[model samples]
Target: MSILIDSAVVLKSYNNNIVSVTINEEERILFAKGIGFGKKFGDKIEKGTEVEKIFILEDEDNLRNFKQVIENVDENFLILCETMISYIENELKEDLDERIHVALVDHLNFAVQRLSNNEEIENPFLMEIKALYEKEYTLAEKVAETLQYEKGVNIPVGEIGFIALHIHSARNCGKLSNTLKSTHLINSIVEYVEKQIEVQIDKTSLDYARFVTHLRFAIKRILSDISIKNDFIKEIKSKYKLSYKIASGVSKILIEQLQKNVTVDEIAYLAMHIERLRIATIDK
Candidate 1:
């Protein structure tokens, strides 16, 4: 007695605890009792809460498609969602609620648009992105809690999910502009650092990239307040001795050549830091 559903069906919330999902010739409305992590849906749905869910359908074909779609789409959606959540968490620092709401809306709209316009989205990269999108709310909520409960900042699950969706949509549309702000910037920087490390480090690239990402976060935390000063170099070296040299060197080269018009001194410093790390490693 397994319920059948279309994996491709669109899940739409209609303002109440009600959600209307449509797939093929089958459509159904289910009351969202509560949709948060670790919560099970029964006969009712909450008005607006992030939730993990499965749609029930009476059609066998729909069910088969649903299984296939979930299997294919889940991985990419999760990554996309995590990236977006990270972006929003970094940007909407003080205004958690509004940021999350707008981000989620923007993301969903973007996703629908992409599916309509693009062809052959079954590519590995696209798949990864979709996987990210699937876990948008959970990742966001966890990120918010980590940032807030652990670091004393407030970011809600709704806002995080929204941002996650927004980033996913933008990425799908080949638009990096939507992710150029705040936490998104952090995400971008992490990406840049990771890429550089992979390019330079070769065999140990992933490991190095992981290290650099954490290093970036730590640096951001340590230098969150002060105006960028030349001492930035000294601080990084002291804080992250191993990667600092290469990272700083990379940072400087990027700032001078690529980011010439960019004025964020912090970014400049980061570029330089990455460069320095690369150079120091090479010299050794």
Candidate 2:
């Protein structure tokens, strides 16, 4: 589906494939397998060209940020980001939000640059990310593998988690802030549990993974207004007194954030998970 541009002058070319061209007074991007090959600034794109995609950035801020990113980042890497986005769309069979171009390319460029310099990348929520976003994580793993084999950059599991989050965000047009809030809320709850129990958790342990996974779903349920009946809430609360106490504190946090009551059943379920975590720590 090619939209004929009345007049297009190439303003910039990226990797002999994508060109930022001025169509009339507006900036329109022309991209295809080889649309920009042998092209230069002031060069006019020919009519009826078999361009694969045209990106019209409607938002001024997004357009400016994207142009800035391309200007400062390496052209070859910018093309790589285009390729990655194409690959992601192919895998998902859906068009992603255009904003991903600015966010993802910049993130990957920084990750690769810093990784080349041996900076330690940490993603404490990697396990939670994998569990919550299973499909996105799989796609991210393939992307990481491609980078390792083709680009010789072995993106760590943590980086893959970040990539998965980006892919998920793009696919659903989800805000990164909301995702970060969920992650932060989960981490805070974990920290609160550890503090209440007075124990330093082994983050690499299965117990920690399970705890995080449960917290992720619990937060999702809370935000989505989903709940389950827990006839055993009172019994569980009585049996796991310490865990119940920690869960009560967690409930307060949830209530403050949500501005509503987190059901007793949900709190009891959290108490059960907390008890399991405490038991595992004591046994270790």
Candidate 3:
């Protein structure tokens, strides 16, 4: 697909290879060999003519970092990064967050540069990444495979874990914590509730599904630094005392195990869900 660059004017050139341009008055850095060759400042770059690969920076931090990385990176490597992103999206059948474009490209650029210098970094979270994000890890392996095929560079297995982290971060957008830890914490909370109530949960029931959904979002919110304010905290504490107690226990589990603090509003919602689950268990 030909991505049209509308009203783009070249801002600056670097090493006669890369050009910084403003498209629709939005600053972007374009990477292409000889893209900036013979181009002067304030030159108008015709869309689809000189632009071979384009990268849109989403924020100030991204723009600053991209500028730093592009200086040392090769244009072909940038192209390969774009191709790999396209391949990942097509294979996964999901639209990844735009952050991946900058994050993954920067990571791969540095990784390849390190590999060329025989400096390979180890990933401490390899096993955890494999366990938590199996699908993303598998796709990351394919990314490695593509790198070897296209660039003739054999990236180490450890790099797979790093790439998987990028994939995981992109998938979760703004939440870069360990997802496996969250899953374990959620399971512990659910098991604790079941044990405390001395009731067997029907995993096949809709109530169970709803509870799990609520827990998933709760965990996500906690990880994303988002909070839910409890407007009905007093009413919930008074009406659903038992459920509130159970919810309090859940909050403790979150703090002890995941080091996450549940908000009062989150506790209230959890209490309501627990009450529903308790009633369902009794009916069963």
Candidate 4:
């Protein structure tokens, strides 16, 4: 008598160490040491194969895009991406959106190639990225180390910011473009506030930190059409007239950029933060 085993049907193969398989009617990318060596489509892999990692992409588009990238990019580079993804999951203690697997891997492949070619990656929103997405930025810095070890290329700090952008976008199941828009909006508002108040923001200040955070959530709420109730909207308008005026200007900027009506309740909330920044400089 011979022993029998249940196995997954290989849907695609990505070299000597990785393969996409369909088992239990779910598509998964399996990674193990030499799992795909001499393996090809329609091969059966043991369901209990001792694997280092298995990525089950629940989203159909993500799975499709993942396979596309895996086929086009080098196996070594894809492995590098897998290493960073594993590290990111370990650091965050949560499974991220599968879209990240598609977006980040594609992004890192291009980034590594650009860096190898000595292309300058410029991030004008670098400071804003650091301030707004601190946790993701920290995680991205660690991922940069993995990139260095795997690819022998040192990821630039600006590229780290881009990684942070990807992480933050995927972590929240949001689009990178939306995050970039929010970052740009926040910086514009900050710049406008400085001009109106004749004061440069102290990025290190706790108050400034809270203000930027507020703006981030504020943009999220506005984009989601989630209005907040500000009981003291009238008081904010009356008491902090200067901040309110500045907030109104900021509202115009939001309307023009977002093309959505901004509630005065939000304007009041913005004024409150502006007032905090304005008050921080008083009697000093």
lDDT of 3 by residue, 1-284 (tens): 44554757888886566788888888887766677888878998786665555777675645665565566567667667877887888887886766566668877876877887889876644676677789989999999998878767788989997788778666775444554565577778889999988998876454665576567656755765565556678999999999999999998887676577777778898999999999999998
Q: What TM-score do all the candidates reach, one by one? A: 0.26, 0.57, 0.55, 0.60
Report the number of the highest-lDDT candidate. 4
**lDDT (Cα, tens digit) per residue for candidate 4, span 103-213:** 778778889899989995676457877887899999999989888887888788989987887887667754567656777888998999999999887754545645765
Evaluate model 1: give its lDDT. Answer: 0.41
lDDT at 244, model 3: 96
Q: Could you tell me the TM-score of candidate 4?
A: 0.60
Query: Which model scores highest in TM-score?
Result: 4
TM-score attained by model 2 = 0.57
Per-residue lDDT tens digits for candidate 2, residues 1-284, read 47554868898887576788887778988767777788888998866677767888876656766777777788767777778888899988888877678777877887888777889567756777788789999988987887777668778999998788778767754456766787688788888888898999876454565576566656765765655557788799779998998998999999998776798888998999999999999899
lDDT of 1 by residue, 170-194 (tens): 3332323422433354445556655
Q: List the residue pairs that clash in candidate 4.
A: none
All candidates' lDDT scores? 0.41, 0.78, 0.75, 0.79
Clashing residue pairs, backbone N/CA/C < 3 A, model 2: none
* Model 3 alpha-carbon drift over 4 Å, by segment: 3-5, 15-17, 31-34, 47-51, 116-120, 174-284
Candidate 2, residue 130: the lDDT equals: 80
Tell me the deviation in Å of residue 15 in model 4.
1.3
Query: Lowest-scoring 10 consecutive residues by lDDT in candidate 4?
Result: 1-10
Q: Please give the ranking of all candidate structures by lDDT, highest first, separated by commas.
A: 4, 2, 3, 1
